[model samples]
Target: MDLAIETNNLKKYFGDIHAVDGIDLQIPRGSLFGVLGPHGAGKTTTLRMLSTILHPTSGEAAVLGFDIKKDAREIKKRIGVCPQELVLYPRLSARENIHLIAQMHGMAKKDYKERTDELLGKMNLLDRASSLVKGYSGGMKRRINVLMAVIHEPELLFFDEPTAGLDPQSRRVVWDFIRDFQEKESTIILTTHSMEEADDLSDELIIIDHGKIISQGTPDELKGKLGEGDILEFKIKEMEQRDEIIELAKTLDFVRWGKPVGKHRIVLNALDGLRRVSEIMDVVKVKMEDISVRKNTLEDVFIDLTGRRLRD
Candidate 1:
């Protein structure tokens, strides 16, 4: 199999801080890959090194077969990056921003015009192409930021929190765009905090924490690591009852394990959760509310592996 990106013990440091420490990855060509972690987890720093924007303190990586250190320029030409923060000229119209990026990439005027128009149409922003970015909503700016990255039609794309703050509708639009791009056989590296988004878009994913890879697999494969069980979650009337609920849940025969999510919530792993719900309720019905049962999910896997919520 052809690999689009490869890293060997990739490390980056700022003084004594190991921002990205000993991460090894092999991303296949034309695959949609996800990197998931919380704030300060080095997701962005790792991407920066892979994208040739930062030099690694130690270790090596190649993007699209070009060495990240030795062939940084070549790698830059074949890759596009959409950073977590908006990077657009507020005074420029959406069309102009995309046009400028295309020009910088050395695209022919005719080709860029067509490409810009096509992207705007797909993003549903063609009608507002002439509007200055300053007048656009946050979602609109995000859409334009994405368009700017792909204007060069790069072979490898890196998106850091592509839909971080968009409304649901706008976020879906971006998701659709990503799907369409993948159909074109472009390799994409995505970093996000949204477990649902990662579950939906990634062909494979890795969970990173404290600058190291904790887990890596397909979504189903990762969830499978958690074993076969349904998830049971409930909220208590008082924060003080959380520990009591967890203890009660653990005592139940059906509960495999139980933990307190926050001061007022408890989550449990159980088989046949629906059938066991009545039994679970019997123990904490007086203190619990908003009880729910569902199948194991990526979020569950994340929490179980990290012992903390994804957003933490």
Candidate 2:
């Protein structure tokens, strides 16, 4: 396969914390890939290694056909990275910032002028092209941050939470640009905690936890890993009562697992979920103001593998 990125036993340690403990990855050319994980799950550290911003403590890796250790300079040139935090010059206009990067990349005189105008227009920032970045809205600044990363027209791109804090409309616009990039034949690797964004944008998906990959496949493939069952979610106002009820649920053959989600919520995964939902209510003998049951979701899979409780 034509791989855009591949890694083996990639590890990054910060003192006692094994931030990105031994993990392997392979992302193919022309595909949009997603890295999904909760906070402190090593997703960012892994991205840093792949982008050549941080060196791995051990293991081998490659990006865009360049070895991470030996060909880092080459890899850096071919890959564009949009980091989670904004790194823009507040005093510089969007165009000037992009033009400066283009010049640094040694873009030809005609090409530099043409690409700057083209990207600004495509990102819908032409109207604000001359305004200082300090005047831009959160969403607008995020868009420009992404735009600047790609000004050199790299073939492989990395976007770490590209739409993390954007409004729905802004997120949708960012998605549009991502779709356009796919249409134009660029490979993208994105890391986001938003299930909606991953489901909508990824051609393939990977989930990491505690510094290792727990799962990898197409979204549908992993969702298929779910046994034909239903999951019921309940938000409880009380904790011990919820646990007591779930303990009773453990005795039922139809119920696969009864797990408390938080201090006051429990989720039950059961066979023929809807049919047994009423029985669950009777079995638990609890009145929940809000109860919902549905087919498996990406979140359910995450919980199934990592446990239902919150991670610190």
- What is the per-residue lDDT of model 2 for residues 271-291, given as tens digits with 9 covering 90 to 100? 888877778777777777588
lDDT of 1 by residue, 14-61 (tens): 998989999999999999999988888899999999999999999989
Q: How many backbone clashes does candidate 1 have?
A: 0
* Ten contiguous residues with the weakest lDDT in model 1: 258-267
Q: Please list the C-alpha lDDT of all candidates, in the order they appear.
A: 0.90, 0.85
Candidates' RMSD to native:
2.0, 2.2
Error of 1 at 301 (Å): 0.8
Which stretch of 10 consecutive residues in model 2 shows the poorest summed lDDT?
A: 303-312
Candidate 1: pairs in clash? none
User: Positional deviation of 169 in candidate 2, in angstroms?
Assistant: 0.7
Model 2, C-alpha of 235: deviation from truth (Å):
2.3
Model 1 regions lying over 4 Å from their true place: 236-248, 283-286
lDDT for position 120 in model 1: 97
lDDT of 1 at 45: 98
